[model samples]
Target: RKGITKVTVEALPAEACRVTFELKRPWRWTPGCHVHAYLPAYSLWSSHPFSIAWAESKPKAQPLEIEMEKIASKNGSLSHSADIDHRPNIVTADSTYSRKSMLGAPTVTTISEVAHRKDGVNIAIPRDSAVTSVSLIMRARTGMTRKLYEKASASKTGTLTTWGAIEGPYGGHDSMTSYGTVILFAGGVGITHCVGFVHHLMLQYQAGTSSTQKILLVWSVPNTEALEWVRVWMDQILRMDGRRDVLRIQLFITKPRHRGEVISNTGSVQMFPGRCNPETILKREMAERIGAMGVTVCGPGPFADGVRGAARSVVTEGVVDFIEEAFTY
Candidate 1:
């Protein structure tokens, strides 16, 4: 059994909640994995599978910026203090910083550049990382999920704590890093399954270990409030190095109350009102695909089926692979 550190009730009207589990020791799993959560307090014999929305290690005393500066100094790549002030903020597995300094700063060196070889094409060393915590987002429907939600809602703190156990970070063996172009389709809580993949791909892309050159995440949510489910994780991803060059996000709000609710943050990440047509989006992406493309979907049955059919319609035009995520209870 593990300790349920915190449970946060999201701002969504659908009664969605995020549960965080603190592991006894470090655990590692690939992207797109899940855990069977057994919350005995809520259900003695019942356990539910939840896709991992985020995972990370416990923070250490030493800051990443100081560590990177030490490494850069060792390699004779450390810049003057004035120049260092203008460098883009670096993000690690457990922390995040601003990326605004990257704009039009030609002389500002990045952590990647400081750690690169003389040839400027290879990373000097592998990143030291581990996972000591796992989090899951669930939309309260029935049974244990509903019970958990109700208890948290009644609490004055708007959070809940209980004993929990998890088994097998399983079924993430499939890899998408080999594809040159990849698109992820998520609906509602399905965003949990795709967020890890995007984070992994971004890390690999920064490390020069992945073949993926382009990534597009197409998510459909009932309202703008649903975006809060992954807002923190997305912020970390957006701050990663080279994120703007390879990643794009398109969000579709199926039931927006007003035009003001649908606002695009930037060119790379845009928001629109109403449902998104899978066929049209798929065809448009296929037209501009760089090389072999991969399409993945994790959503309700009808939404997954629509994405599947759309992918099938374009298989003859290019090398396309389709993956659908589902769980059998």
Candidate 2:
């Protein structure tokens, strides 16, 4: 947990970026787990928590993926220095300073400049990966994240390798193996969580280790760029063994680049335009119930609540469990 890792940064659309961390040692985690990252140099010694987006167990392979979003710091400097974004003097939600201090000028900073900070974009962890190898998909916002983004963008090559620290592959304990039908719902980056489960369950089903006979993955993203968030991972899952036989994926793009871009495959994978209606999708799946169904949601509060309500309405239809994976800090 105290090892230093090398990170490669690649920018993505929607002000987002991906950071691939190469661990110096081995690491392990379950599908829903996360890790705490301590970028002491970039973040004023503050450690932030982010969900592990992807991981692998191969020897010498990078094993942890963390998706990050850049948050704007209120009074941070944007001078573009490698070590200039640490704003420990500002008042924040968790700071000891009172609310009045938050409304006034930062006691330590006289100049107001835009700087990027890091924020966690909640997502899923890849299954069966060594704790040491990982990747992070993140969006650039204000202080540390912005600095990181600028550094990556300014890189002569497409990648920027830097030093980073990782701790704790935490909280992926929920399991869906006991259910015969498993339905997963995701919104935006939340699809990251569901994608790993799809891989885990599919492999288990193929090996006769899981009771899940049917798996349905429903994901809602804003646009094609957002789709790129999990394009590589989804591509891999689509090609998994017996994927078409046991798995079905439905992608709903709330905002499409073009109406024609909302395409669909005739088989197990389908794409549609507009937001996903939780109740409607739940009702349809419950109508064609398999064995004991498990409904898991990882997204916004409103969306999760809608799914929870939908799952409850159909409880009498069969044995259904609605598991929500969400946290606030």
Candidate 3:
């Protein structure tokens, strides 16, 4: 569980949204985990899951950061979300699913932040204006999730469950380190999860690992807004290839395609959206070409479903290596 302090809006290019949050740091969190916040001020204790986009404080002078989203009011609460001056019945927190919250916000705990001053060991990362990607620190609270949900808006505590855990920074999958060309499938925020994947592979190539791994990122975004936050990530990926040939990204716009603009014109990504069909996957031809071909995905509900369906069929065909990190399984 976590608490929200300062909230801000961050941008990528043409899109903007309520993006950042100040979370209390030194709290144990993994790059892939999400903090479920409880807003008691809103008579709500349910944790709104958010990936730990980034965190600092290690090498000193570093600040911790968290990415948040404010959508078009879901539960008949427009003013509540808009009024960020800290309103009553408006407590913003993560799902109360921690050992502390479940056992009842502990008076003490240790979370992610700076390393330590004891052995003079600390990570040295330069400060930059780049929010490359958003990450989440998750909780594995499977007890009375139903009760926690019900008691939030209403009074009756039903039974519910959230089975997850706190993981470290996502350096990406073990497969990314392998040689050979790689075809990547990322749906939604799945793109963010791949920062480590792309970076590590590129680094390996630069280090002369002898394993020239080519990558194709097929991304399906939720809307134009989501793309904005991701544009920075895209821009950097673009520069990683001096010859501009490091990674190939094929982005699909599933829900919002406007005015014949399949994708934004910066050459940031190749665009298309809609469910990722088996046909699309088939066209990629990984199934027919054997020898070290792998497929991976990260995205929203439908995109995830599409990936599973298409990839399931491909795996059965026994030609491609399908790797997945299920957000909810």
Candidate 4:
């Protein structure tokens, strides 16, 4: 069913935005799954897939409460919360992007330099509400994503609440609860896929529903600003019951804006400078072997390949399984 974009916040790092939408109907999905969004406003035939970031625990009569610090704006103009790039690009005068072709056959303009094929939008919906709401964190790439960014930039409040449709809560089926040690690796916005698994597994471990005892979430990003992408959700996960007992998060920032941005908390949550070496991390994880280890990765092709390679190199070690999430359309 169609969902209404209720709130949109220009997330930090200048390349992304956090959007909230209220679904017309109620739906439940596994944490690591995703949803496809078809924006009729852009083009009906072109649908984008996004992971489900956060969801409501139980149905609620009230809308999900979103608590984010409002970004300042001057004269009610597009606030800092909105990062709009008004730079005009050279589009072929051909009918490629024309309304006729968009209707007859979906075609999108490709800008090689600035274009990054977005995996999909991630959503967090409230439970029990007559109208369910979801928050989507999007990075402006090319075509539809660029259009969405421009539209929001043109908004006075920097909000891009609009009419859109969602399809399927796909691919969260792999259950890691049977394993004793679970390691998740995420890159950039790929963190959306792993966030739900962390939440679900923590709850399962806390309630003693499954055998999972150790969950190590390793997230790699470009800079500190990129960290803002999942800050809100991470804050919530940190407070979950027995979270400290089962979760260990290692954040890797390849580029730091300044030396001060490279702070580490030591044990539970630690921040490191530069990229991570999969082999080193995997070997260390093996040294502290808990039980059977399940390694899952959701990120760029290179990162996924690296994780797979590392896991394969150590197959001789106890029970180690590797799962990779690839939503290639």
Clash count per candidate: 0, 32, 45, 8
lDDT of 1 at 272: 82
Candidate 1 clashing pairs? none
- What are the per-residue Cα lDDT tens digits for candidate 4 across 1-329? 55544444453345776765566666665667778877777766788888877665324353222211122233465454567544434432221111122565433222111122221222232221222655566777888777787777677776656677777767877768889999999988888878878877876775688799889999998876666667766655665657767888888988776565576634677778899888889999998868999999988899989999999988898899998887345
Weakest lDDT window of 10 consecutive positions for candidate 3: 108-117
lDDT (tens digit, per residue) of candidate 3 on 60-91: 23222111123324444444446443322332
The clash tally of candidate 1 reads 0
- Model 3, residue 292: distance off in Å is 1.1
Ranking of predictions according to TM-score: 1, 2, 4, 3
**Segments in model 4 whose C-alpha atoms lie over 4 Å from true places:** 1-12, 57-131, 153-156
Model 1 agreement with the true structure over 1-329: per-residue lDDT tens digits? 34443333332336878887777776666788888988888899878999988887655344467776877778877744635553454643421211223455422211111221222211111123457668889788899889888888778777777777788788887769999999999989999999888988888898799899999999998976677678767766776678879999888989876665565646777778899899999899999998899999999999999999999999999999999998334
* Candidate 2 residue lDDT tens string, 112-207: 111223222122233444455666666676777777777777777746777888787778787688898999998776775676678778767867
Query: After aligning candidate 4 to the native by TM-score, how far in Å is the CA of 21 from where it should be?
Result: 3.0
Predicted structure with the largest TM-score when compared to the true one: 1
| TM-score, one value per model | 0.77, 0.75, 0.51, 0.74
Error of 2 at 121 (Å): 28
RMSD of 2: 17.2
